[model samples]
Target chain A: MTLGQQILQQLINGISLGSVYALIALGYTMVYGIIRLINFAHGEVFMIGAFVGYFIITLFKLPFILALIFAMIFCALLGIFMERLAYKPLRDAPRIAALMTAVGLSIFFQNLMVYLKWIGASPKAFPRVIEITRFEVIENVYLTSDKILTLGVALVLMLALQYVVHKTKMGKAMRAVSQDKDAAQLMGINVDSTISFTFALGSALAAAGGILYAVSYGKIIYNMGTMPGLKAFVSAVLGGIGSIPGAVAGGMLLGITENAVSAAGMSMLRDAVAFAILILILLIKPTGIFGKNTREKV
Target chain B: MKFRSLIKMGVVFAVGFVLHLLIKVGFINGYYDHILTKICMFIIAAVSLNLINGICGQFSIGHAGFMAVGAYTAAIFTKNPDLFIPAAIAGMPRFFIALAIGGSVAAFVGFLVGLPTLRLRGDYLAITTLGFGEIIRVLLLNWKFVGGASGYFGIKPYANFLSVYILAVITVVVLSNFIASSYGRACIAIREDEVAAETMGINTTKYKIIAFVLAAFFAGIAGGIYAHLMQAIMPRDFSFLVSIDILLMVVLGGLGSTSGSIVAAIFLTIVTESLRRFQSLRVIIYSLVLIFIMIFRPQGLLGNQEFSTPMLKEKIRLLFNRTKSGKGHTSTEGTE
Candidate 1:
């Protein structure tokens, strides 16, 4: 293949992967914005979502769309459950305590999934629900049906998220809570429910991302959410933690950089590259690409 | 004060000598010895992490990276035939030298990392440190000189329980002294309120970095000991999970409490070792314990309180004096 063709192919691959990252990153950025918590178990939610999707398709012989929807609903409920059970009690505790709880929850879910005998700590091959059909986009560049489907679903969900955040009453409440919880409470907005709703929205997106990732990668594991989940966080930080557009942009950039590095024959450095970008961005512009600097109050 | 401190050191050394004799005479068998050595290593790790996270109020989740640096560097020194003196001269002296080199190198790396990233606060600082840790692990994996992903093996077994125990004691003593010093107070002040500390002319960043470097130094020594004990070192061994394990020890013991760290480390090592039979249930139980502890007792098991030797001595002295003075038995109970 020509250089141009390779570049084009990598871009397509990067965008598909980036879309998955964006989906996960959305949950991270939203949670961080609302509560100033990292929500470490968000990755585990993605893992459970993939498992949910896998069971729906393989066990029940359901259609792909149905599996995706069901996974999103289950994950949304799980997210709300986690918030109510673990995080709610520690709402006024020290930030470190909450962070530790998140880590504990992450570990709990990962091990719990393994403890369930039916779902051991082994990778399962994702059944291909969509048939692959390649289309030549350019002289030597090709696009697969899986990539197209991933892109399409991610775009649709992201757009829906955008609409929910901008064009809905809940979104307005979410925005208020994130901006100032005390004022939002004073404004008669149900702060607790809004926070729960944020978790649900973010978790539903993560579920979609998980299924999309499983379908594209053709395998799923109990702990598969760890690396991607971390990378998605890096993307969230890279773009500006609290900004929606920043998460999407950060995800795409991370995906492209990883693919470009792999194409340059340094695939081993792919994971390191994301962290390096994260550190550099943190040092140079801690507020991120689109984040505005806010002064600390005494 | 100097004479008292010297006597304390002598007592510590005497205790260590007795323990060493016990291990030599097979009173403490291999299984117990292994657990004891691990307890020592974790004591060093947990105490050092407490200095950074508990005392200095800086959240560093990448301590294992510094530990890895120390382990790999010390291993390379002792294992390489051509690096220094001949094999005939290579013994305790050589091992001590390698440990020093490892510790110094880790401290330098800590300085490098802490200088740039310590300015950030809370979660951002944590994520940055975590990134540095992953970056270090990746770099080590790619460096073929240290055997890369296959790990560096055949390290000299110079780190016995005695050596680890002595070092762990020394770490605790030094850190306790440091925490009592004025510098330690500054670190505590920063932890309490960074802006307030800065307003009081504490130079918050400098103190934070100092604590970080000191913590990293001890962590390096602990890593060096770990490499020798295991006789093999892998980059994967010092992954993020190991850092979390150390953090768990510090948090469980009560952050900023040296004695608490020591007790917690010993308690956790034994508990984890005993649970080896049920491997899968072990982590689940462990995590559940952590979650419950965080929710119910966020201040930790000791609640930032220390059970110092002096305090114990004072209590014992008071009990003896009360009995000698022929005070009522009820008064003796009130003394406690």
Candidate 2:
């Protein structure tokens, strides 16, 4: 391949990579938006979702559509249960406690995967649902079957998420709770249910991301979530952690920038992109793009 | 008052001496001795970690990074200690001098890291620190001059049971003294409320930096000892898992309690080694233990209190009157 073509392929790969980040960031952004708590375990949920997806196909021999649904449903419930069991009780505790709880729970889930060898310690091969030979989409431009599927799935889910957030009663409740939990409760929005729903929705999105992640990477490992999770977190922070659209923007921007940087012969620069962006955005506009920046109360 | 505290230390020292003799003459075993050495190392790590977690009140998740920094720096220096040890021993004693320099170097790095990121709170701070740790691991892995991913080899073994216990004891004492000092109180105040601490004229930033630097220093010294004991060091030895293991000791030991860290470190390290018998079930069971602790005993094995006699009495009374017990009384209390 020519230098220009290789650079183009790398950019395409970055965008494709960026799309998954946007999906996971949606989870981080929404939860932080409503609860003001960063669910560090969310990434682990993504990992679990990938495992679920793998099992659905490999163990149950389920169809692609069914596997995706099962994974999403499985992860959604897991997310809800996590909130109910671990997070809800510690609501009144210090933020540090919640943070610690998230870290502990994350460690728990990751180790569970490691110990059971549930999906096996090694990265399992993702089931091939699509196959296309290397073919030029345009003159000297080639696209793989995997990249198209990932982009298509990510875009579709994002739109669906937008619809739910903009047009549903649950969305209103979520917004109300995010705005003022006490007032939302007084207004009879069932604050508890809304929070649960938020977790469910966020987790489902993360699951979707997870499944797509497995599909795109063509392998699933016990530790597949750590780097991607961190990347999503950066995305959420970059676009203004609480804003949905901001997450998408942040994810895409991060993906493209990282790709361009790598094309410049610095593969190690990938993680630096997110941190540098976080530092810059935090210093300049700490609240983020769509976020109503608040300050530390004395 | 400090002199009086020093006198109290003298009595504790005698008791420690007796315990050491009993274990030594009584056969701690090569296997058990190995476990004890790790426990002692963990004790130092956990107590220092508490400086960040309990004292400064920041949820520091990147402790492994500092540990690695200390570990590698110590490994680098001690790799050829014969050249430096003689000159230092002729003057200020090689062991103490090398350990101090190792710790000081780690502390300086901690200061550099803490300055920019400490302002960020909670998980942001955590993930940032975690990233730093990963960066450190990769750096050590790729820095071929040191030893690359294979890690540096051939450090002379200077650490043994005696040095491990001595250093561990000194860490507990010095850290306890630190937390008991005005500097320590300022750290607690910052943890409780940074805004209020600042209002009270404590430079919150400065104190947080101090706590971080102190934690890094001890971790460095421990890493130094670890380098000598292990005789070879690798980047993998100080991954995020290493941080979590130390954190388990801290949380299980009751965050700010000095004796709690010592006891918990010893207990957990031994338990971890034993759990190795379960093979694959080891980490899973360990996770379950942590989860159970979070759900049922969020205050940890002893909460923020220590293994004092009065504490033992209160704990017994509380256990008996457990049904009548409440949250606030059980948690958030100082051991002393």
Candidate 3:
């Protein structure tokens, strides 16, 4: 590929990957906005969703589309379960304790898979359900239909999320809780339920990301989620932790930067680029591109 | 507490030393002996990490990264011992000086990593530290000049149980002293509330940096010991998973309690080793244990409390006094 074409391909991959990052980051950012805590296990939730997709589609031999929906719904329940079981009792506890629990949860899910599978961190092939023969867009540039499908799903999901946040009753309640939990409660909005709903919403998005990821990658592995999860977190933080738009921007930027830098044969600079963005943002504009600079208060 | 406590601890340690000698010379083979040494090494790691996560209230997920720096530093020295030891013997006055320089090298790297990353708090700090851990591993993987992805190996194996225990003792002493001082109180203050601590003039940044560097220092020492013990380590060995294991030790021990960390370290090491028969089921169990603890016993095993009663303390005092007076050595007393 020519230099220009190479750069274009890299950009395409970045944006495609960034779409998933944005999807996952939305989950993180929404929950963080409400509770002011980073759910470290959010990554694992995505991982679980991917595996769920695998089991449903490959093991049960369900149609691919049906498996995707099942993954979303199943993971939504899990998101609700996590909040009720792990997070509800600790609503008043210190953020550190809850954060640790999230970390533990991440470990638990990863190990849960490990225990189920005899091999640890070993890659298992996902059935090649999606055929990518030729969906080329330009001269000597062949784009898979998987990429287009992922992009479409990601866009639709994000739009649906925005609608839920702004144009729906539950979304309005979530907004209220995020803005002021006590006041939200006084207004007769069920704060607990709203948070749960938010979790479910976020998780559904993560499930979509996971299925697409599994489909695009054509393989599933235990440790795969960790880096991508962390990268999405960086995206969430970079774009502004609580801001929806910021998460998208951050995810896209991270995905693009990582791809571009690696494509340039500077693969090692990937993390540095992410962290440098985080540090620079923290120092210069801690709120992020779309995030408002927030101060901690009870 | 009052300087007399050190004397009491010394006598107990001396007795423990004799008991250890008996065990070492007794029915165990080199394999279990190796495990004992590993337990000691992890004890140091767990205890030192407690300084930051338990005492200072900063969640650092990069313990293994600090260890990587130490391991690499010690490995370099061991790999080229002839080059440095003789130069050190000439440049310094004693063999101890070269060893001191080696430990110092590990400690200094701790300071470097701790300087910037320690500024973060809570999950943010955890994320930064986790990133640092991965950065170290990736960088080491890319460092093909030093064997890269294959790992830097073949360091001289000068470490054994005795050296590991001695270094662990030193680490415990240094950390305990540091914790008992006003600086330690500053760290506790951060744990309590950063705003309040800052308002009260604790200089949160200063104490945070200190706690992190100190944690890093001992982690480095433990790493140095580990490098010599395994005689082979890849970048994969120091992955974030290793960091999580260290975090488990600190958390399981009851964060902030030195005795808790030590107990947790030994417990986790033994349990983890024993569970190795289960293969991949081991981590699943560990993760489940962590979850169970978080759900049911968030304060951990012993928590911030001691395993023994106040009455046992008086009994121990009398026993120690008797041992000092030559009534026979008070034996079988362990902190756990």
Candidate 4:
């Protein structure tokens, strides 16, 4: 492959990776926007989604698309149950308490999955659901069908999410609650259901990301969601927390940079580079690229 | 009053000395003795973290990074014969100096990390500290001098139950006394409300740094003790999970209470050890306990209240009086 082809290949890879990140970041940003709490356990939810996909495909012998749908639905219910059980009671507690609970939940889920008879502690090879056909668009510049599928599915889900947040009644209610819960309540919106809906929406997106990720990587583990979850969070913060479009852009940017670092023959420093970017971005622009600075009322 | 307090401390020291002598004479079994030493180290780590998280109200989640620094520093100091400056001067003084150096390095790193990052409140600081810890672990893994992923080994075992137990007592005493002082009040003020403390002329930033550095220093000390006790140090040992375990100690006991930290540390250490028979079920139970605690008792077991003699006496007196009165409800309202 020539230099141009190499660059193009990496760029394609980056976009595919970025879209998965974008899906996860949307969940984080939406949740943070409403509750002002970082849902650390969302990563575990993503992991569970992957495991659900694994079970559906292997046990039921379902097709990939059907398995993906089942995974998303399972994760959506899991997200709602989690919010109701662990987070709902702590809505009025201190921020630290809520944060620690999220961390505890993350630990709990990881350990529970590990101790389960079927999952165990090992990483399972993800089955290739569909045959991959590499298409050579230009000389030496190749794109696989898997990559295109990832990008296409992610774009469609994000577009759907945008519609939900803008074009639908529940979406409008979600917007109002996120803006101000008390005001939304005064306007007769059920704040509780809206929050639950938001959680479900975000979780379904994360499940899609998880399935796509397994397809792209050909492997899934109980704890596979932690690193990606963290990076997506970085993307959420980078794009400006609570902004939908910002998450997409940030995810793409993060993916390109991470892949670029590995492309430069510094693969060992890849994870470190991502975290370094997070620290630098936070120091320079805490509100992120598209975030507006909100004044803290004393 | 100061003299009386000093006398009480002297008596406690004498008792500890006698206990040490008994252990040295094999009065206690080796297994229980090791557990006691471990309990002491956990007590120190938990109490020190309480000072920062509970008293200062700073959300720090990278304590294991500081422990790693201390452990590596002590390991290297004891291993490299050419680097043994104090050890050459005296045989026993070497361990003390190595422990001090380990603590100082970790404290310095804490200062550097906290200087800029501590200004940001809540999750930002928490994430940054956590990142810094991961960075340290990664750095340790890449650096070959300290054995990297293979771990640093072959260090002489100098840490013993007597020294570790004494240090634990000192940590508790120092932290409890500090919390009872004006500086501690400043820390509490910051915990209550940073803006209010700032308006009241308390240097919130300065006090926060002090508490953070102090906590790091003691954590480093615990790490140093842990390294010598095990005679080997590994990067994986100080992962973020360990940090969470330490935090659990503080939260379980009661944040901001020295006695609470101590009780929680000992209780958790024993419980965890006893649960080893259940294999992986221990972690699941542990996580469930954390969730349950947060749901039912978010303020913790003691909720910033220490175990005082007066309270214990009041409880005992109430118990006796209740039996005498033959009624439980009447005295229960007035006793507390």
lDDT of 3 by residue, B112-185 (tens): 55655555444667777776777778788888755788977776566667667777777777888899899999
Per-model TM-score on C-alpha atoms: 0.94, 0.90, 0.90, 0.94
**Model 1 captures what fraction of native contacts?**
0.65
- What is the lDDT, from 0 to 100, of the residue A172 in candidate 2? 86
Locate the minimum summed-lDDT window of 10 residues in model 1 chain A. A289-298
TM-score of chain B of each: 0.88, 0.85, 0.83, 0.91
Q: Which of candidates 3 and 4 reaches a greater TM-score? A: 4
DockQ, every prediction: 0.63, 0.37, 0.50, 0.56
User: TM-score of the B chain in model 4?
Assistant: 0.91
Q: RMSD in Å for candidate 1, one decimal? A: 3.1
Candidate 3 backbone collisions, by pair: none
In candidate 1, which residue pairs get closer than 3 Å at backbone N, Cα or C atoms, i.e. clash? Answer: none
Candidate 2 lDDT over residue span A1-298, tens digit each: 7888887787788888899899999999999888878888889989999889888899999887788888899898999999999888877776777777787788778877877745557768988867755667666878887788888988999999988888999898899998889899999889888999999998998998899888877898887888788889888988888899999988888898888888888777666677677766655676677777576675
lDDT of 3 by residue, A61-174 (tens): 998888878989998999999999998877887666777788878877887777774535778787777777666677656677888888888998889888989999998999
Residue range with the least summed lDDT across 10 consecutive positions in model 2 chain A = A114-123
Q: After superposition, how far is residue B55 of candidate 1 from its true place, in Å?
A: 0.7
> Could you give candidate 2's per-residue lDDT for residues B102-205 as a string of tens digits?
88888998876677667655456776777677777767877787798887888776666667777888888888889989999999998888888888999887
Task: Give the Cα error of residue A211 in candidate 1, in Å.
Answer: 1.3
Candidate 3 runs further than 4 Å off? A117-121, A133-142, A268-272, B1-3, B23-28, B82-117, B120-122, B306-336
Candidate 2 residue runs with Cα over 4 Å from true position: A1-7, A134-138, A272-285, B1-7, B15-26, B80-96, B309-336
- Runs in model 4 with CA error above 4 Å? B84-91, B321-336
